[model samples]
Target chain A: MSSEAMVVGVVGGGQLARMLHQAAISLGVRVVVLDPDAGCSAALAGAERFDGTWTSAEDLVAFSRSGVDVVTFDHELTDPADLRVLERESPVPVRPGPATKLLAQDKLHARTTFAARGLPVPAFAEVATAEDVAAFAGEHGWPVVLKARRGGYDGRGVWILADRDAAATVLADAEGIPGFLVEELVDLAAEVSVMVARRPSGERRAWPTFVTTQVDGICTEVILGGDAGPAGLAERARELALDLAEQAGLTGVMAVELFVTRDGELRINELACRPHNSGHVTMDSCVTDQFEQHLRAVLDLPLGAPDPLVDAAVMVNVLGGPDPWDREGLTDALAVEDATLHLYGKGHRPGRKLGHVNAVGATVEQARTRARAVADALGSP
Target chain B: MSSEAMVVGVVGGGQLARMLHQAAISLGVRVVVLDPDAGCSAALAGAERFDGTWTSAEDLVAFSRSGVDVVTFDHELTDPADLRVLERESPVPVRPGPATKLLAQDKLHARTTFAARGLPVPAFAEVATAEDVAAFAGEHGWPVVLKARRGGYDGRGVWILADRDAAATVLADAEGIPGFLVEELVDLAAEVSVMVARRPSGERRAWPTFVTTQVDGICTEVILGGDAGPAGLAERARELALDLAEQAGLTGVMAVELFVTRDGELRINELACRPHNSGHVTMDSCVTDQFEQHLRAVLDLPLGAPDPLVDAAVMVNVLGGPDPWDREGLTDALAVEDATLHLYGKGHRPGRKLGHVNAVGATVEQARTRARAVADALGSP
Candidate 1:
């Protein structure tokens, strides 16, 4: 019955893939996930599976060759070499192609690329030895940020050094690891993210900029469509994001995380080539959600309107609580009628993200209050 | 990992079940379908299958016993006796229980029951022979409607007779049918439908009445939140529907199809005990869609808000066309970005319901115009 239907193969069976599968079903499209775990999160969503590890070139190539019209990703964790092999051997194309992924998978590469394209980024340089760290800090500042070039996500592989002692402690701890980058830490202000989707046909659309809240370097909240900043800042943020998408040759949704200094200067912080936590607000607030737009872009279909449908929408993350399970908390969370809750169906692990609550209102404060209440009621049990 | 999760078993695995599975996935709930056709529409949505038939008591009982927390339905086509058997033999509860389903299954039972409860219905009588139809017509009018007591849907098993000869022809054609009903052909100024979701706890929520357009007997379009009628007519329709739901002891979503006569009277026409076609507009317009609401109602979860999120939402059905398949038409239809399209993964069959398009706007006319354009562009392939 689906002989002529479009099929997309996703690299990781995570929450992003689960949502992609959900969005695809309404359009009569099929999503197949490739993952090593047979019971990954996307499996609960009933996504078809191709059992394989993203780290292996053989697995990547086989999955790409298996009946899918296009290949995509839930995360940028696949090995660059493996993706290169898949690109050369498989008939299907891998979206957000290997080159763009390198710009996400390798922080140093992303920093260099953004800087080269006239995108504002912090002063940065590669450093490995004690002398290297000291020389960079001497030029920039004493307190600096240390980051690994690859294999980092969700606050992992990152260290903030305040002074000599802190810098020495981190350098000693990272004895043998090779790739490293150091950057000057700027004065704290606010954090924001802009998500944009690009199609292979050069069509691109951007969701409005969202102000985000971070706890321990993890996104805790995202507020969309509220002009809580200086005039023209959001518009400039969108322009920067769209320009980055074009420069990276992006073919799917990409989240451009940015930092606003105390003096109102915007600097690029990080890049995620797939759906990011910040885009969750679009699930309820925008005409086209990030997940659906990602699918449309990968399938080479017309991009959906990225404009907000409501005045404001807020999304609050739900982390696993201290208890083994809290069925009552789940019920209580759902009772917040104005909010929409999404549980990822993963088993509880304290401090781990398990779900999120979204609410839309006439103002950012109203939506944020409702979302916060739902998240609090869903407190770790 | 999901040993504590809730599972719902659906009696039919059609488009309704497909959408239920899609909705449940976001809430960490699982939906299992019992259908003889392993490749039913719900299967495309990744719903688990029970490998049974709705018409078989053994199949239903075994499915209900298969570790499900609740047993629900996609359509009212399940055999009432089979449902009763499952209720008596299985541990799970059957929502929209056997008693309520009997009213939807048998036209005579629904008419007599509605009339007995002081609800308005056209003058109707049981008819099994030519004399029965003729005698009822003589009292009511020359033109009447002949309907089977059971097994009728989408214009099937119904006949409009203008004279004695026409009534005689229908009586002859329905020779083996054991039961039938004859009703006065009331002058219909408009057709409307109101959908209500009732939990086993007696908590009921109703969607606003929708003005629907029908081609033959199939609903072709639905418009919500339009004040096109006399003052207070929509509110009255909702009250009547809520009252009927209570009278039927409904435990799930029920669509009350009604006829607004030229004489300014509201009369119930037909009863659907599961998600009905008219409620499709809620999928995009209301805060709580019928599919998700049906799952929540059956699961006995706190009901979500049912108010409209937009000023207006319109849905237009897409029928299959002359060609074997029209991928180009599908693309053209989707290019109408203002409308959201849902295409059931069914093979081409001329005049068959292929899918639907839903659009929300500032006005009913605007939404309807966009929806109609999508449906027209998706013209039969």
Candidate 2:
């Protein structure tokens, strides 16, 4: 009912920020994107572009003075120290603050904090050398997982080692990568993610737990009403995500990615302090999508219902392919009735995310089949 | 499916253009708005602003050369003669062309065309003086409706003259007004509208018929599955709308406003070349909202399905109130679950359209009740 429009400054201008910009129009809000790339995807969507990077405190200060009511990040690459400096120097409110964002930016910090809070997470230890990894593997067993504590994504920062000799080789190969951590590699059954939005006023809501399929360390597909994994796993995932949101004082959308072991134990894998790819299905199937919810959370507005609009829905990401970018099969893909396609307006690169397609149907299998077909069509030459 | 992003040039920067800009993001298209007002609602949504008016041929030429693939109008105020000149000078294709747009811009032309085509329209005649109005009234009876040929919106260009004396006074006061047409006032019933999207390639689709409630000639609310007027009136309205779209060679969304007579006969009332207020409910209830459909039609892409996602939906317009714009009751309005609010980022003036609220429910009455409550809250002091 208010005619007052709020300007939200986002630190990154990727697809998440692009979607947030789109969602803000209906809410009468303005999004100012601060990305070094002049042609970032969000900027293409008409976001007020400010040429800046995550590490530039001077740029953040200038953006704060440019009338942004609140500042949030599209990615967790911003250094907590830089954010703190911005918070102290600028008048704009930094949502989810540095402390909360750090839990997502640093894997070791999240694992340690969740472990200390009596939450279920993989057994992990800081790995300074091959011996540290060997020691951890000796206690946990062979085939342990090694991960870089920061700046690792899409399986790039992680390695699975079979023995102490393999650990030494991996450690040697990862010479320049900083902040290594070793963890037990559990016998996994499946992977699932839960998205939660929390406002500064403490109001929080969680979307339904959904299953995610990963290929080469990147999410390829997500299905709602996921394969009824361990009897109570879904409920537990929702509870854990909500509990973490409350404990972390999260002031926007956060996703908790979890691994379901063969023995039915649920363990937290990682956290994303922004809208995650696993929730893209919500765009077409839920009463309120995650991007809109993220804006509401940061703006401290009342959360909307997260109920599903259809019986089942699935989303498939269209990764860049070996062939050059072309819409050769787009007409055929669009012929798959009821399937919604969203192109990110980005240049093509092998294995890079180009866009996503969502399909809702009477059953999950039907939705997944239609969604995959459309995504395959989009990726084909 | 082409990777080439299409740039759409819109001639107005009002709420319709704002919504179109929002819709373009998902389609991976770009919208360039040409409006003289830098602070127009669409410009605030991040549309590329052209900083010019529709009447300026130089601006139109520059916009076309700036890489806009197609040009469209959000309002009917653009003179057809000006558009003709621009079309001859610019390479960009102007959708609906000048001829189709003229039908909506000039009432006399539309009435004459539809009548010549043997369409069901009220008996009407051109009136240039008080004697002409008196002569038309002598034949069609008293209490006839008079409408300006151009530049009228809401209730501004229309008047109901009761007798010869009133007609004389009205014509005397109408000194410099443009062309006028006097028509027989139809007997009471209900008013409804049907929206259709037509592509240049001959593809056409229509949404379900709905009823509109008007206050002082401005739409206040629209309800889907309108009052069960005649047994088959809805079907007939759809047929007529589609027929008109094809007959006019329409290349975008066109709304056919119709009057349902007490005898179950449908009569043409007016036409809107762009997204109409009566179709706002489609944003929440239909598979494809009108704005997206408009873009699809103009681009010659496959039109999305118009099936309803819910059993019924209602949309209520939020008119500016006596009090200054404030968010005093926004929280309360948002508390109504499942109701979505869309605010146009425009400065408020009394009687101006500020926003709209939409609600979906099991029945039209139930949805209308909730939508009206939210709209009332938004307009309250």
Candidate 3:
């Protein structure tokens, strides 16, 4: 806002932070990272890192002392009360304050807010008892989806209740966690996500939503410049995301996941208030990469053009298999022409997200063709 | 020769290493950097750094321990004897070796090599005595160029003998330096540099030669994809550089600095056997940047397409001024649309290489127009 390079203090030590660091370098800004781990990916930029957690008030005060221009996150699990307190005494601004971040952090709150706004969403209700789950499933005709309200990711807190019997089994697993939400399982044609950016000044820009393919409930690939539904569906989804961001007072990057049902209607599925994997392909395919756009939005800089630079771009997640000790496997995958491999610098474990690979070419099929080859190399025994 | 990523070990820590680092990232190859300074630009890539003197065998041995696929340099001033000894125990290979590197390191050797090969070079002789200088000056007329055989840069190791009295004053500066060479000064109309890359398999690729302008002997700007002179001049410059590379057995990026004289003849002014600053504009303008080409050649990877992406590109060097500070002024300059800035992360000093800014657009004049604004911002008092 002051026409100076804004210093962003990012909390979390992961690949997201690492990429944000790279984007900040190009903009001539410094990123200060707060992570307890020394080998965090963001440390490669040589950004100042305080060894601590986001919930530590001492750590927050130390971060505040670093002369940061703003405070943001690589992941959206920050304590709302902590953020609320920090905003009162912070040296810099905190984005998506307690009131708004809750809409993303708490799944039940997000569903309620969406339904309250008359947005098209699957019929869902907060479930605290077996009767609540039974009634919702009975009304929805069966096989309802139950999800934890918080602290869930990568399909971990979600379960599909085949019937009342299956609901009881999953209820034992959801034991002490916050209240679960029961939603009618819409017979969806495909799952897609639209990534959008918004400045505090009310400016919004959307990237072309892409159909996503998943494996074992984890996102496996993202194909840009395509929506399984009609062209208008993508635009409609983008409009919904923008309206939701404005209503929720969301700043920076926000992702709206959508499901296109058999009737061709777009319904809100889930939401992430920070940069999402669905937008990773933008790093190579878009004129202005999404991570950089997030930094610009958070810093309140003028938004940049978000047009696609290629016809289509496909991104495939590189998951770690058992005994994932091979480096050449990844290198061999990269040898394919026009393929870019990004390793997340994480130790490998089965089903863990080590990194992702992106390919851009003449068509979605062409990009996906190359992307499959890269994914095979990662999963190769 | 294998399809494995060839590990290139580059010696010296400067802006060249920084660009080379960026190039290596695109190729998915690891570069081991040996620089005495911890803050060397190439260190940004997490390139293994052995911070020690060029003459230290311990440092050389440390570099050889992990085994490099090929050892090259960002600076050609490395001691030839030391390099030759290290090659024996090298884990992988060293490109050019001591013999070829010396040609670029010593002006006397370079001139003799060119003369013996019957290549076009200015009339010159080693000035061991005043008679040698006087005879050459008498035959060539006034305004001969005097250059030290080693250890000089940015016009510091060379002098212009405008007249007999001026020659006497310049001769004193070259006194302590070894083997000074005197050459007839050509009435140069323009300066251009030809950048060519040679592979171990005798494959060679040449980038479009561009006109280079210098201020105070430091490269100030590059006009990429421009017709520096006539078509014939560019062809001749390319041919001369290729011939020089083949003759010297150079197997990496070679830059030939040429002078187009009033008579329309091209003469080799100097040569650099590394990623030259004159090619920096290629990073933003060329389809395959010169650094990527250098990495390809050194790694023996399949060369990439080297066509120009934009019609024109201009590179403006950010030389340090009397003040030590961040590039706030330079950032302000990039407020112009379509400008890309590359900072080397070096400490500020008077007359030091800090970083560079580039602009690529539809026309040479347009690119230069925008580039000058950024450069002016960086160098403004």
Candidate 4:
């Protein structure tokens, strides 16, 4: 509350941190980002750079020594053990703490916690053996989703088992892993995500639930302000997300991914403890960009208003295709009226989240169509 | 062009350079900035920092020695001799080249050039002595505008002469300055500026001219995409600017300041070779931001369209007020539904350009009103 500038320290120097750096700079706040590479845009955007792994205790200690007001992350892979150490030794605040972050970091734990909280989750069970998977399928019916309990992102660690034979093969391969979660494969009409920001002071706010489209389990596009569900469902989803944040002891931006079935039933799918790809559209379409709000929440400042600035906004991820990443045709892409492109300074890897493009339009479908066209022009699959 | 990355060097570290850096990054290009400070935002934006004076030949040589693909500036204050040396030795493209930059760098040269080109400009003469000022005013006018030929900006280095007596006082006090221009002071109705981008390939584009309001010679606000003159006059201004660019062998974004007299005649007032303050609203209001277009033009990329995205947009500068700058009530400014605030990370100084706020509305006046309210809330004078 004082007139002095606030310094926020972010862990991991990925696109999320790069955006947070941009947001902090806009508000005249300084950010210190500790990343594994110095070439990341986060470092380029005036964040005091310290190169090291986030999992290293010594590096975290050095990062905490910067006298930052708060510490957050661009990725959830931050070592929980190191965070626990930081909470005790560092003077700066750590949002979401280790407990809430663990819920989202580990798939098995997230399911258990949501189930215990009496939330609307798909029918699920944690399995360690083929028999356990078969038994769960026998009870919940066929065609279930098998997921790794940790470190899966962008459609990397999930598989659908339509029958007992496939379930046997998947479970046999999951022997050494912590465990796998089996969930009913609900027939979904669409997927949506509600991004919310919460502070330790108990203030919470959520952006409008946007209908998300995914291909092969990787989020491909987001349609803002859509009528994907029944009337008033967005508000309900926000309430659920806020409640979940509180229950999970979250203290920053957290995205709750949800499924809307053919019957209009809403189900909580998963959660991300930091800025989500689904919220990337906010950089161009929201009154208060989500990254800025995240910094505000984590720094214990008053939460900003979460209002969509446009009637419809669609964000399409620029995932790398089989072809080499040439960044060619960007001139044509930039020629799109009202198009905003954010390229993460990440290396080219097939199906990797290289960047995203957001387009604002009068309708979600129109925005989505434009966004997809731009993404395709940028070599998206 | 080869797909390999290339570097562009900028000679200043102001907000224009900062925005240009952002634009360059989107095109997969890099920039090296030579600012006088180490911790400036442009330096942090991956601009390899070389801190020194812009007018120093040694500094310019050091900056030019880096083999940067091109050398440009956010502001046109480079010493002419140093620029000429760099052009001969390094062969890096220098936009607005040295010849056009003088039209802005030296008021006397600009006036004479405007007259020679048969463009509409105020009646003016180079005043080496107070007698010359008196003669010029006696011949064409009573009140006159006296401006120092170089090294003045943002209301500085300009004086209004009411009569021979006032002119005598300024000339007596401004002894040995050697370079001053006396101009016929037109009874102005409104002020406007046209922002145009030109490529080395002879391609040129211009954004709509907008009426600007000034306080104490510093621009207070801009009303974008509004008619500042008749449609025919506006088109003429754009053509004249493009013609001027071609004549001067200039390549990059250029802003032309003009006066629309009560008689509906438009006259050239001044020229800015870099991104001007009047173009700030283009960051959020235009299809291709002026800063981005400047990069595209200088890099020889095909320029994007310069269409206005909104019906009207207003940009209000956050001028430092009389009261010591306070961070109080900034949240209130940030809370405005349609206002976008951009704060430069600089220590406050009286009458300094810290940042600006932009707003869009159905009408120019409405947007201007909202922008001013936000700037006022941030303690602008």
Candidate 5:
């Protein structure tokens, strides 16, 4: 309660950290980011940057002691073992602790944890060889999903195998490595995600569920509305997310990616234990955006309302193209009715996420059209 | 432009500049601020802060040449001669230039300029002696308003005189100095302000007129609604602001304060040639906030829509109180329905502006009550 503002240290300096720095400015909170990349998105906002990698315990512990009140993450890239060292040595507490972050870092660990905790998850089995995958496919049907146990994101260490031959090809591509994880491919009616903010006090709130669209395993758009997909499921999705959030012991904002099956059941897909791209729709519509909510949660301050201020909102991701991200259409993007554009200060590479456009209106279709217009004007990849 | 984000140099690091830094982070723009105080409000945002004063011509010119695409003022504190040097010597354009900024720095000059251009203004006069004050009072009324010709804000250097006796007391207090300006104290109605963003290309846009409430010469609350004041004068106010924006050649956001007469004419009162406090309401309610609009305008990219996204919104200034500002209530303030709190990182001193809370709703009264509640929770001065 002193006059000095609270300082929050972020582990990664990506778009989440960048948006957190922006939100912190108004709260009078000082944000310090420890990212090895000096030109990281957050460094552009002037968040005092420390040159350190998130995975290095020595750097994280050293960075944590340098006047931070608490430490949080923008991504789950830190080794849980390293973070345990941080929690032991640092003066301030590490949010989500090692256990929660372990779930985010290791997919096989999270699936087992969810299963043991009675949380809904797709049928799965940890595999160590192609024969194990073949057995799981025989039980759960073909077109199984193969996933790395750890350190893979944005569709990178994931594979879809139609049968034993395809599974053999994936194993061969991986130099015949036997270790990986496989799961039953749900009859997905739609893909949805929910954002939850939980403090150590066990105080938590959930943002409206978002129905997402994916292309080639990468999220392309996020939509928020009363009837975005399967009828009357938004409230149930939020409840499901909150229940799993408690099980995950998530701190700050966590995105619970879920698969809504055609059989009317919600099955957990993956856990993103941080402010996520799917929640980007909240930035332009929610009463308190997820970035601010994350700060409040980590600081253990009173939580903010997670409800949207608009009827519907949607966000379209802008990816880098063959040339480069053309910000020249910024004016035209702003000209789109009810559209707001946000571009990350990053160098363009083909198919890389450069930024996003959010639009709000009375209906999902109306919002989606305007948001698409802005992304198209910006030459969306 | 070649995949490069534009850079802007702001001459002052107050709350306006701080808010601009927040807006620019999302736009991928770089902001460089020149301020002598290492701990100015904007410095906390991590904008690259240059150690310099706004008044020094050497500093102004040097800061502008530091690879800025355009230079803009957060306040009109720069000496006009000094800015003229910056305009001539620096590669970047000085928006609102020396001539436009001079009018903001010198009120007497603005009144005279508005008078000459046939703009709506109260009857006024230039006075250098007690006799001149008496002559203006004789024509206008017994009681008149006196203001300093330049360098005054937030209730400083302004006096309301009752008669010759009161006038004599003010003169004696000033040691017989008579170099000031005087105006007729109009029969009261209401006070309102409009913000305009004009690009060098002559493209301009005006935000909705805000009816503001002042307490002892300090703006306490700003209300935005069609019926905020007597009858419907918002449209007329916007037109008048746009007209003066062209006359002033202002290439960024300009706030024009106006006084409504008991009978129904809006007379121009003051000009703030940068992002002004009256437009702070736009941050929470408008499609394009004034801070972002200022960047768009000064960069000459394109003017944004200045319309409010909500039906009505209101902002209450949180002034420093008896103790230091209690950001402890940040949680409760945010809990106020539809309220968003913004705190300027300031060392609190009684009567100094600290920050503001904005709330939006279906009606002005609804928004005001919520905004007031948030301000009260924050221990508003």
Candidate 6:
């Protein structure tokens, strides 16, 4: 690796990659983004662009040859097998190597691995047919959550089935019964997430646990320094996240989403091994943001302090609304003294994550109110 | 101008422009940098590069044609006449217009204007020959400071002459004796600066005053919020900066450097109508950094709060050492947990500004110590 100028090759040019590219500039690092679209968000942010898809080995190899020191991913959609091949063929190192990346790509694999390690996770069973789902539901309860093992995001690959008939209908519509998993649906009071950064040397650090609110399976807002749940929930969530990072041998930022059940137990819901939406508040509220931390970890640099710079911070997503774009009210949003707006350079589409607003205040409620106001201003009228 | 995505055209691509581009990403503003060097620091950070010198009117016009909404500058090295021509020719508006820009480009003009407005300034006189210097020294006392009226930075274009013979020697060495100004050297106890952002609408905001320490006329460290002088010093500095911004019709970030006398009086020393090194600490220590404020002011967006995020912050510049580059000790520097490093992507040269390290702590002493340690580790062996 050239220490003069470290070049990181990211496999996707989404908002995560775009933010990483922005953070890289301060560290004197260069980011080369590999995406099929030439005008992806990262490209607009000035990352060196390589026209290629994540699944194409030839494109990945070309990107690696273009003077990149390390290869990483913005998302976990790339096949682990393809990454392994690239790792063996490319000159640069692939961070969060195939083994670690696969842990996040496949839901069944992650659940089974965590269970084997005696982690607190939802009761889960692999599903091949409607009978498998029915049997799992019979043991767990009347309602169960079904999730595809891979390639699903937002609300795309998850479903809550209350009975065998519902499972049968889902199964009948599937093509050749795609790989899936069934889990016992726990009674949730709130959802929280902990973000942790782990280097290849086994060094790990985590941010304070923060509460997240999702609407229609989409992250609508994140609240930090708020009443997350029962006492000790934050500590327990942090411990769980750190342990997972170590177990997975993660070499970058990892977000551990947890379900805070009504019974006060913490259950692992999902894992994302990249800069996450839940941690977006860190951009304005933390001493060192998650994107910069991810870059430092993947580069094996010493970790920065993750201390909060404010008493409370809240982030609200600016999901694309009915209008193509609503920038007229941007001035109004900017009127919120502490509201910091970030817009992903993307064409507008209903429900798309166009941007987000962050606000810091003495209390989480105040911060959230200000952030939501800015988000509302930026949204379609 | 498309509010959907504002494109700001910057006239220089140095470290200031590089930082502005980094800040622009979070604000969803695209920066088109017009610099002669294709590999300037801002270009390396992913800003759109328009190859052209600051003096080339054609280049400026071409840059404005590339879908820019407003034009700004990273430095005051541009010829004011060219800016005036570009203002008349280009479709986009030129911020800080040519009139405001001229106030910063010519030191004599700035001093004259400020002095005419009853600002507190050292006694000064323009010099055309050694006789002029001797005459000014007769009134101001020995060891008067002589400064070139334009294109001077760091220690360049500045000299101190103790007598007529010393002044005669300097004038003899000068190439055609550039336009110079003589000022009485003040018995200064410390140097402090206040950074303020102004819009064309006459709205102005200033950050907390900071103390700057310089060696050989180049700033080496900036300390914020601790022993910056008397309690009212900050308020006075802010008032002075705001008044200057208003009187000069300044737009964007303006830094007013003041000399704090041993007897507790503040005197204006210099003015920079862009992000200054004195405000670099704001990147890691303030709620909203100066670079972001510059972009906001130039874009006419509502200014953000400039509250300090910590009790104190210290920023130490990483002046280039004997070595062309220093990477071996980066890991050592990274050992300082709260020390954030910012390296401009530039080829190293002796005494050049390569980067800066910032640290925040409970006290300015603690932050300065940490920041200085990191900077030392990154310096020459």
Best by lDDT: 6
TM-score of each: 0.97, 0.95, 0.82, 0.91, 0.96, 0.97
Per-residue lDDT of B3 in model 2: 52
Tens digits of per-residue lDDT for model 3 on A73-136?
8887777677777778787777756667787788888889889989998999998777889998
Give candidate 1 misplaced runs (Cα > 4 Å): A1-3, A175-178, B1-3
Instruction: Tell me the tens digit of each residue's lDDT in model 3 across B81-112.
Output: 78777777677667757777788888988899
Off by over 4 Å in 4: A1-5, A44-46, A200-203, A225-239, A242-250, A302-306, A309-311, A322-332, A335-337, A361-374, B1-4, B44-46, B175-178, B225-249, B322-327, B361-370
- Candidate 5 chain B worst ten-residue window by lDDT: B170-179
Model 2 stretches with alpha carbons more than 4 Å out: A1-4, A230-232, B1-4, B138-140, B225-228
Report the lDDT of model 4 for residue B110: 84
Q: Please write out the lDDT profile of model 4 over residues A1-381, one tens digit for every residue.
A: 212567888888877887787677556677778887777766654457777778798888778877787888888887678878878887777786888899888988888878887889899888877778889988988888989988888887899988888978876676556668889998998788999998887878889888888888888888887887787777788888988988887898999999988888789888999999999987777757688889878876667767776788899998776664443566556556667677765566677777898888888878887787777777778
Q: How well is each residue in B1-381 modelled by candidate 6, as lDDT tens digits? A: 113678899999999999999999888899989998988989989999888878888888888888898899998888777888898998987887888877777778878988898899889988888999999988879999988888888877889888999888877887853488889999998999999999876788888999899888988889888676777887988898898898878889988999999888999998888898999999998878999999989988888888887898999998777765444577778778778989898887767788898898889889988998887887732
Grade the docking of candidate 6.
medium
Clashing pairs in 2: A327-B1
For candidate 3, the docking band is incorrect
The count of backbone overlaps in candidate 2 is: 1
- List per-model TM-scores for chain B: 0.97, 0.97, 0.93, 0.95, 0.96, 0.96
Q: What is the lDDT of residue A48 in candidate 4?
A: 71
Quote the positional error of residue A239 for candidate 3 in Å.
Answer: 5.1
CA lDDT for candidate 4: 0.78
Worst 10 residues of 6 chain B by lDDT: B319-328
In the predicted model 5, the residue pairs found to clash are none
* Per-residue lDDT of B217 in model 2: 88
Which ranking of candidates, highest lDDT first? 6, 2, 1, 5, 4, 3
How far off is residue B337 in model 3, in Å? 3.3
Candidate 6, DockQ score (0 to 1): 0.57
